[model samples]
Target: MIALQIIARLLDYPDEALWAHRDDLLSALADSQALDEENAAKLSAFIKPFCAAELLDRQAEYCSLFDRGRATSLLLFEHVHGESRDRGQAMVDLLDQYRAAGLVLDSKELPDYLPLYLEYLASLPLEEARSGLVDIAPILALLAARIAQRDSHYAVLFELLLAISGVALNSADVAEKLQQESRDDTPQALDAVWEEEQIKFLSEQGCASAEETAHSQRFAGAVAPQYINLDAHFESGTAGESRP
Candidate 1:
């Protein structure tokens, strides 16, 4: 449970507050009983360098990984809903669940934000948290595989979550999936997406338009400053910027 909270903090955008709490976070990570020996080693390798790096470097890395495209997006419902109208109602239902669990989101983060969900899970009973992780294990696995492909340390967080949820990632399956996957976050792909949208507006409504707009990111709001850390619950400070 504590590890869930720790993962939530580390998974959020790295900011000054996170840097200030680096020692504490690492200490707490070491204290967690949930992590096995291999997981402990993996986290140490990930966390130490992450904390040792320059603050700006960390933030820039975060933006590059998450902000460019939707493939490795942290917004859980994006994977599930994919711009369908049901996504809206799903957010409503999730927010209601948050309130029912005696938690409130005063920030702009919509429900299903992964870190926020992990924090909520950390607040729950052991079995309850495990069940929550189990429900979304597939999503976590998707993210883990993608991050692992990038050889980024961030993959360890999702791997830990999967292990806690009693799920094992299949490396061969992940390899095949990655082989078939296009790099959506690349510069050319991003330009093409915008160009396609422009053409859709200039053209009539038809199959071309539908296919072009299929990957539209209509709900992603402006990237703003928000604290997704223990700060507001501790003190006030900026955390990281994740385009939810």
Candidate 2:
């Protein structure tokens, strides 16, 4: 699960501290016997360019890809509900889930942020973490495809996440999800997407709701914060160290 923790950090907003420890993070992934050989290689390949790039360039790209557009937004519910009231409710529910597991969000991050979710997963027992990862596989797949369409290397992170989940990647389903939304990253396109009205929840329709049941079952057990090494490293300062 340290590998998950490392990947989560890599996916977070770039900073000098993260760049300083880039080698350490890569070393952890490369040395991890837990990661499949292919994924380990893919991960290294994915990160190597970022490590070699100018820090500001890397930060700019991260901001462009993740910060700008809903198509590649890292907030989970944005893909699910856009800017609707349901997203607000889902955020509250997800925050409650985190609190139930004794995690307090001291930072300004919303509960559905993917890196925060990964950090939460890293805190869980391996089986529970894997189960939670599997539960979010669809969202991961959707994001992976979106990034890949832009030819961004960050897609590899999502690929590694989906691989770790041990769920079969459904290309057709991912493609379908992609097709349902506009891929243009323009402000107008984003406004158009957000303009769509919110759909009612499954419970509101009085339908049999497996998703509701799964949500309840997913966070049933609470584990204390045990991934101290990485957590401490993250909290020590900004994300990366300046290059000599």
> Clashes per prediction?
1, 9
45: Cα error in model 2, Å? 1.7
Q: Give the alpha carbon lDDT tens digit for every residue of 14-108 in model 1.
A: 99999988988778877887788898778777788889999999999999997777878899888777788999998999899899999979878
The TM-score values for the models, in the order shown, are: 0.80, 0.72
Query: Tens digits of per-residue lDDT for model 2 on 63-126?
Result: 9899875667788777667767898888888888788888999978888999999989888888
What's model 1's lDDT at 240? 31
Off by over 4 Å in 1: 170-172, 201-244
- Score residue 172 of candidate 2 by CA lDDT: 34
The candidate that achieves the highest TM-score relative to the unseen native structure: 1
Candidate 1 matches the true fold with a TM-score of 0.80
Evaluated at residue 190, the lDDT of candidate 2 is 50
